[model samples]
Target: MPSTEAPTTHDLQATARRVRRDIIRMTAAAQSGHPAGSLSCTDLLVAVYFGGILRHDPANPFWPERDRFVFSKGHATPAYYAVLAEAGYFPTDELLTFRTLGSRLQGHTVMGNPPGVEMSAGALGMGLSFSLGLALAARMDRAPHRVYCMLSDGDCNEGQTWEAAMASAHHRVDNLTAIVDYNHIQNDGFSDYTRYSGDGDRDRVGGWVLDSGYTVKGAHPGAGRGGPQGAGRLMVRAKGLDSSLRSE
Candidate 1:
């Protein structure tokens, strides 16, 4: 079971460090994987799993009452696997076999292969919709568990993402929350061609997100506040890596 009490800041930091190390080692062993994305989202995962933001029992991953965490940024499985392993969902040693021909830890997440994974995702835009479905199912079942979807800025550019966002709002899916890893980089290069904001550290990107009618709340995962509350809201955080391409 997850810790009933919140983890101390030092504990969270140490866990984040170990998770990041695992991400690097796993990707290095695989010889091909998206380490950057994994690294970027490490803190978020750490906060959720170790900081007690997510209610899950690694011993019984399929527990019907556990909150669902959907990694919409599918390629970031290195972090996903590492976090689950750290949380005791599976043996940490299995992480080295990631991307191997027969390993359950594939390049992207596949449900049922690993114990904690709630969704099988590879395409960019589909995770939000899938999470929405889960949220809706829980609602229909009158289940109390919440659904969380972690996305990348690239996913926001997808039309389906917007569609799902609007639908989530329209349906009043308050049990679902979307978090975007606003790293500003994507598979095709930077997510947007726009220039950096006046602050220089941030970019003036994802204008379409506001146009999509979703309020984006900035969050710092290390704070352990458990992300934004309520549904139909997108949480944007600058905790991701600036580059998407993994340097060999």
Candidate 2:
């Protein structure tokens, strides 16, 4: 098992590099996979898994008290798989088998087969809703687990995401938190900013829910595609959110 101690900055640096390398190698071996988003989210995930922001056990993936993470931006399995492997959830060698016919590491995550995957993510915009359900369920059962969902700018554009966000607020679901990989680039090309702002209201925060009383927006103007700089900035913001939420 990997050490339970929180990794030092140097440790996180090395692990992030290795995870990025794994993402590249895995996608190259498969000859077809999404690497950009995977690369973009490397530091965010590294912080979550290695920075002591998540409660989990590779040996007991189904531990009742383990925190649940849903990769709403499911197509970015390259990052997810690499993080899982480096965290000791699975052997790193299996990363090269990604997207292969018999590999458990498919283009998108499938829950049961993969040791750490918490959701069967493929369709966009549904992860937050699922996470809300999990968080609500834990509240009902008085469970101590927290639910996290990682989304993309594309996922946020979906109507289901809005509804789920609204519902989460209405129900006072404090155990759930979501992070968006708003890298601006989707499968096709750059995302439409108008769509994100909902009818040209660029300042509007998706009109999620005013009653929730919790909102965070971190915008790094030129960091979106600036390699490590972009990833690092986003990672820092995400790490802060995860840390603050954990305290609550």
Candidate 3:
């Protein structure tokens, strides 16, 4: 209930940049979190949090009518926390306590910590499934809220992602939209070498979802395919997507 007016593109972009700065500062304080992927997702987070797609109130984090967001890429909690703080979910001063003992901000996202965090995410490939369930519940209740899931490309290698993908589509959860942060890199090395063997199966994963009848969207800079009708397609960069439903 903060405000219904949509945030300006310039203001959203600036907020994202500030969130990026916070991510770096928090991770540096934590000394053991992922920065590359976190930085890469700053704009996407801002677009969702500030673009009016998400019905969130930092003061009322448990609002039933609010849109839900899942960070499947939980290692990027630093960036998530930054957005939550900027959105007034919590005191910005608490950001300094990131990763410290007894602090709510941990290396990964946890539900009990603070407001704005919707899921307990740390294990990979679980968020999409969780989001699918949330969307399904919303459908059952005829709720108007949507579910936004942010996943990492490398995490797609897990069978669970595909399982959830199939489920999301089979259930026809149109309210569920998934965004993958394809940074082309994972923990050990480049995702091509580590996961896909450079076969471009990374793109195939999204293709599979589309084939399964779920609308697909990519953050990759060069658009190669179209999503289903009413589906969004985006070409992403470090700053943001070329065309995104969440774009500022």
lDDT of model 3 at position 159:
81
How do the residues 1-248 of candidate 2 rate in per-residue lDDT, one tens digit apiece?
A: 33568566667767878998999998888899899989877766786777766778888988888888888888999999999988888898888999998889889989865878998987888998898899889988999777767787778778998788777666767666566665667777976542332122221343221111111212223122222210111111222333443343
The TM-score of predicted model 2 comes to: 0.79
TM-score of each: 0.81, 0.79, 0.80
Q: Which candidate, 1 or 3, has the higher TM-score?
A: 1
Winner by TM-score: 1
lDDT of each: 0.71, 0.69, 0.69
lDDT rank order: 1, 2, 3
Q: Give the Cα error of residue 81 in candidate 2, in Å.
A: 0.4
Q: Go through the candidates in order and give the clash count of each.
A: 0, 0, 1
Model 3, residue 231: displacement in angstroms?
Answer: 8.4
Q: Per-residue alpha-carbon lDDT of model 3 for 1-248, expressed as tens digits? A: 65777667677767877887898888887777888878777766776677665667778888888888888888888888888899998898999799899999988899847877888888888888888889789878999777778888766777898888766655555677777666677888865522323222233434332211111122232222233533322222221233442442
Would you give me the overall lDDT of model 1? Answer: 0.71
**Candidate 1 vs 2: which has more TM-score:** 1
In angstroms, how far off is 185's CA in candidate 3? 1.3
Q: Candidate 2 — which residues are off by over 4 angstroms? A: 1-3, 192-248
